[model samples]
Target: MNLDDLAEKAEEYRARDAGITHEVRVCVAAACQSGGSLPVLEALKAECDSGGTCKVKGVGCMGLCSAGPMVAIAPKGGAIPDSILYREVKPEDAADVLASVGGAPVERLHTPTDQPFFARQQRIVRENSGLIDPESFTGYVAAGGYAGLIKALSEMTPGDVLREMTTSGLRGRGGGGYPTGLKWSTVAKMPADQKYVICNGDEGDPGAFMDRAVLESDPHRVLEGMCIAAYAIGATKGYVYVRAEYPLAVQRMELAIRKAKRSGFLGSKIAETQFSFEVEIRLGAGAFVCGEETALMASIEGLRGQPRPRPPYPAEAGLWGYPTLINNVETFANIAPIITHGGEWFAGIGTAKSKGTKVFALAGSIKNIGLIEVPMGMSLREIIEEIGGGCPGGKAFKAVQTGGPSGGCIPAAHLDIAVDYDSLKTLGTMMGSGGMIVMDETCDMVDVARYFMEFCMSESCGKCIPCRTGTWQMHELLDRITKSKGTHKDLALLEELCDVVQATSLCGLGQSAPNPVLSTLRYFREEYEAKLTAE
Candidate 1:
């Protein structure tokens, strides 16, 4: 088949296949694999081996990695009425799942589609997540993947694209919460011959994998988003700077890019439009500092990946000294939707301030630790108790670590606090790249602060003394506190040092490094005082 014919044939096959075959997609992703998905896969295969024409495919990942060994069954028609999403599947549950092939509906494995985790989520960025095979371009296309790019190129003007984003209330998911439209407008208006769009996949936060999951589960979604972004911002070249640690995510993204290029979805005049866009992959050397925009830009340019001070922001002077629109993976993933469906539709979903759903890598002591996307204005108590299924060991909820080492810890008393940008900041935390780690009573608050302090100290870029030296000093003090060797004077010293670090820090690394310490002290002052009293 020629290129056009092959494309047509692929589309026809996908549609036809969707009708005749029953797709039993099992999660063989990293998180699910660790939770015994292989055995579940074997069991499903064994059932399929004994029987009829059931297509049991091993897909990349479901965002709900914690509720692993997940299973989804797509019936022989045009998508089942909410495809059966089975969590915590075991090998023994295989027969019941397979036996339900004829639409009996497996009662035990069926997860309600109307729950807060699924219901509250407006899956624009993560549309293909947990649904399509991350490696397959055909699968993505089948799920209305490139349609947004098609819509953008065919109908929306560059100005229109920028305007829609501004109206959509889409903010940067890359921690800063900058208006995406304004950022794009800057790059679009910049007086530069060569402009670049960058996808920041260098997700360095300790328990944060929302970006990694999107890259692994829906790489093409990100690619489609980037392509649309390049068109929107008048950029010819783009790059995705992902960290080296996410081997699977990198591999999947690389494969997706190749397929997209081969299918004429990425190259010159994509889908027969005047816009031409191409993207390259730059692998970061696993430097945590690279998560910073300047640092990420520097690393992409083959430098040491350190952050320089900002008057020449990336939009003005970026990679190779050209205008660049750098957005996080999740940020880019939201582009297509803002294009396809009007921005108003998206804006209506979440809170007035924080529009659209936020995806999080929910982990730690929670019973249902996994990746979840919830709308803004949801209470922390609701998330922990209702959506997350509460603490695993039935222990008392202690605190939650939002935003990463650079984030703060929320005590149990503040569980009712609304989880929005302003609210989190008011509580001495920021709605950082959405990593919510639940801690139970077993966790030592002093140790938690010390752990995050150490992470910040180790990951500090050392470009600024406040982050480099201050984080170390704070960590040392925290170490003393946790080890029962701290005095009242040391506690005072830790508080004072956190303030100095916050005041004098450069970039977000130094600035937010004291957040965990500050927030912990605010809520858990008694805990710190208790340690000293015990000593």
Candidate 2:
């Protein structure tokens, strides 16, 4: 299809939608689905069909994942403002929920939009989240989707797309803070006939759901970004490496890719241009290391998933020895917006070093346990206290874990620190895929470190000695310490192991595995020291 066809489709969908009196959006994302959103959606659909006043549509994550299954209702021609949200909704409550549409409010079920949990989030990556039916091509087009891809395909050349990306100042959102434009430029510059763009969606972090939310909420957004990236880097093929665990995300993305190809946004000759791109989903068998760029490409190639050294990085020779462009879900999600709104507009959002908003999956010990997209420089205190609504009980906040097992923990004293890349690293933490797990005073720091060490130890692919053995040894030491049977030498040995692993590990996984141990040592040495024997 052509540009006018896309616009015409959008307008047609909008026109059809405007005629409906009430539209009900049921959160059918993994979180809400587990909370019985499917049954609730069925109930709403049945009720709406019976009445015809309200039409039910299953949408993506509504962000307040903690209080689900959630549903939002709005009168036609009006968006979220005219909508009313209901939290902790049940299948039986669907009838009552429908009654509240254009009528009186349900006091117990109503979730206000003005709350800091909703108000504070600047949702660029998640702009379509909770608002659109993710599976609907017409719905996405109606919401100004594919315009970026159309713009890239029709108006600008591939070089122009790269220039716009370079101007945006966007960085890799998948742990490493590499420049997005620089990576694309490297792949573009690489002299290869076959380059590939891979979207790393194997989000295996213990508490991180950021990538999954993006994939579930806005699959087309990621697809569009992939299309733009493919066009920019001269790559004709792409793969989305998602974990087998995230069935819903995989399902949605698979559907979206099929729809995208059929709509001509992806696959052969898009917008009547000679440039062609094809995307496929490669399911990762729950390996955390596959989230790494090299490992992910290896997985896509039907090999054992493990990371290799990165000088001849993915840019030069990757994915069957041709140049490859790798980025995660959130990174891709940012591309469409950066293209639509000029690069300078995006550059103006966050701190000087870290540009654009970061989507975080706030989990553990927080009141508002959900997905949120906040400006990069937002303070840890603001996220934990204000947006996340702080620790649930009267207990004082203890620490917040910024990254996953590969990241360190920041104590309560450093809560004022901005949640940017460099700032977090200074405090002994890196933004590891935006999995921010808040901890309260009740959490034992020693046990917390042990818990994460256990995760790294388990998730290690055992391909390298440092990651495999070091993580195991560290877990052993932490296990001894947390069990209250450790001596001073154990702590020294653990510190030594951290240094060895950080210095010598073959991949980012092994290298950063010691983060939890190191950061805890830096911030809460008292906790570790208290557990030690007097000898």
Model number with the top lDDT:
2
lDDT of each residue in 1-535, candidate 2, tens digit only: 5568778878988887565787789998999999899999988887776546667899889788999998988775344545788998988887788878788879899988778888888989988888889888888999989988887787788898898889889999998999999999989998888999999898988899989888998899999999999999999999998999999899999999988888777888877889899999999897888888888888888988888887889899899999999998899999988887878999999999899999999999999999999999999989989989988877798899988988989988898988899999999999989998988888998899999898899889998998899999999999999988999999999999999999999998998999998999999999999999877
Candidate 1 per-residue C-alpha lDDT over 108-219 given as tens digits, one digit per residue, 9 for 90 to 100: 7787666666655556666667667777787777666777777778778988888898899988997788988899999999987899999999999999888988888889
Q: State candidate 2's TM-score.
A: 0.97
Candidate 1: which stretches are off by over 4 Å? 1-13, 18-21, 36-53, 76-81, 87-96, 103-120, 533-535
- lDDT (0-100) at residue 245 of candidate 2? 95
Worst 10 residues of 2 by lDDT: 74-83
Q: Looking at model 1, which ten-residue stretch has the lowest summed lDDT?
A: 1-10
- Count of steric clashes across candidates, in order: 0, 0
